[model samples]
Target: MKNTLPVTRYYGSKRKIINQIWEFIESENLEFDSTLDIFGGTGTFSYKAKIEGKEAHYSDIFKFNTLIGKALIQNNTHKITDAELNFVLTKDDNFNYKFFIKEIFSDIYYLEHENELIDIMVQNINRLKNYYSKYIAYYALFQTCLIKRPFNTFHRKNLNLRTNDVERQFGNKVTWEKSIEDLFRKFCIEANSYIFNNNRKNTATKSSALSCTKTADLIYIDPPYVSEKGSHVDYHSRYHFLEALVNYETFKDYVNFEKLNHEVKLGKTLEFESKTSISNDISSLIQKYNNKIIVFSYRNKGIPSIKELKNIFIENNMCCRICLIKTHSYALNKSNKALGEYLFIAKPKK
Candidate 1:
């Protein structure tokens, strides 16, 4: 069966291992009435829990990602209406749409015309009064932006990589060439299809893992991974453009002017991205949710090695089990060697 979940090309997305994660949950017979996906990057896991008849509470530090969770996970019966879709697609000649994208983003990330289209569409989306409709529109727009990018990431200032005439070993040129309107509509349809109530109230909150007060029967932690080889995945830096888009009103202030792509500078750093702070960060999380059945998703090659994580659980007086799920390699991890997905399941001793 095709995975119809609301997903984007997020770097650490669990879309591929979702079934395996679910299978693990099933095999353990871990019955839970509710689940909290603390670092809900793409909300794939929370959406899966909702589909499986669990009250899903999703939280993310990024506003853009939280909007996605709100649209797909928390939203029970709301979908973008035909009228709203028409409003977003239709351009009003009389209305003076803001030229933020056309002026600042010209020749940087997208073509001049494409940037103008984004400005216009974003303006139209803001005119929406219904919160759910607005979120769904933004979700579609986010996915549209990802599909058009060369590597589905805004990590580098490389518009030339997509536009230049050169033989490429990777990327879909046709998909990149598609109009933003077409891609927006395509994702809108996909997002709409994933909207339904599982008879449980779901929630999406804007919070950091350390600050989130919500508790659940089960907690899934998919913190940003730091590779043992000293590579770090900073999601805020990778998707800063989308982060800027969601916070367009105050976005100009956050722009890192030194950068060529006009990437947003997230004022704060996450400990999870730092080698020195990772173990402490993971330890803090384990201590916080020590009472719940804590499940962590980690890569075999990640820092705070599998053995280290097991020791952390053991130190917390919890019984831990490690399950390895074989999966495809990520673009970031360019090692030709194989990689394994690790799930660390820890239950507090009674």
Candidate 2:
């Protein structure tokens, strides 16, 4: 079966192993008619559930990710029309397009002209009438931004890697040099193609997992990765540009002028991101949904070890099973040959 879901080069996205994960879930015969993907990065896992005719609810802390969830999962039948595509692609003088990206981000992420194009597109997309239309446009824009970046992340200021004439052992030089306008148009079409009706009412939310009161039959928890060395992957710092795009109006207020890369500074830190608190956080989360089935995606050697995770479920009065995907390798961390992907499937004791 052809998976019609449009995949992005998202860090820690499960698009590569989604089918395998689904196969495992199906093989176990775990019963669930609805799913709540708490982290919902790239929404591929939830999309897989949606395609299987389950009611999918996608949630994330970042507004940009929620927009992606809206465009792909919640949006049943909306597709970007050619006229609407052209509207976002073309600049309208009446729209009062600001140069937030162009002025502040010059010599940072993209070429000057490309940054200006991004500024224009963001303004135009905001003027779109339909809610899903705005989200679909932003989805395409985010994909274009990600594809053009060196590491597919805005964590570093590395435009020199694209512009400098040097022998490159890594990176897609051609894709980096491609026109942002063309890339935007291409992704817009790709996002549109992924839209279809699954005959279920799916929803997307931008809220912390701890704050989510809505319960589902199955809760899929794929929290941010915390390494064995206590270092955590800060998605906020990595994708601050996309976050700013979604919250364009008030983004300047949250900008940290101290950072070289101009990362957005949020007020508080999440407990799950801390090495000391991650174990407790996971335990608390599992306890919160103690009565529901949960599939927790994690790495073998993460902050809270697989043994600790198994114990967490057991402590919550749930029967847990650990499944290992030993062949899996991370895209960015290829040097770590010892790492393996894991899933802890837990259901409350009857």
For each of the candidates, give the backbone clash count: 0, 0
Q: Write candidate 2's Cα lDDT for 1-350 as tens digits.
A: 33676676887778778878888788889889999999887999889999999999999888899999999999999998888889998988766678888877879899999999998999889988988999999999999999899889988889999889999987899999899889988998899889888899999998888888667899999998888874565777788899888888778788777878887765236658887788988988999999999998998778788888888899999998888866665656667777788888888999
TM-score of every candidate relative to the true structure: 0.95, 0.97
Model 1 lDDT, full chain set: 0.85
* Model 1: residues with Cα > 4 Å off, grouped in runs: 1-3, 329-336
Among all windows of 10 consecutive residues in model 2, the one with the lowest summed lDDT is 262-271
lDDT of 1 by residue, 116-235 (tens): 888888889988999999999999999999888877888777889889999998788899999998999888888899899888889999888888998899999999878888556488
Compared with the true structure, all predictions reach lDDT values of 0.85, 0.86
TM-score of 2: 0.97
CA deviation > 4 Å runs, candidate 2: 266-268
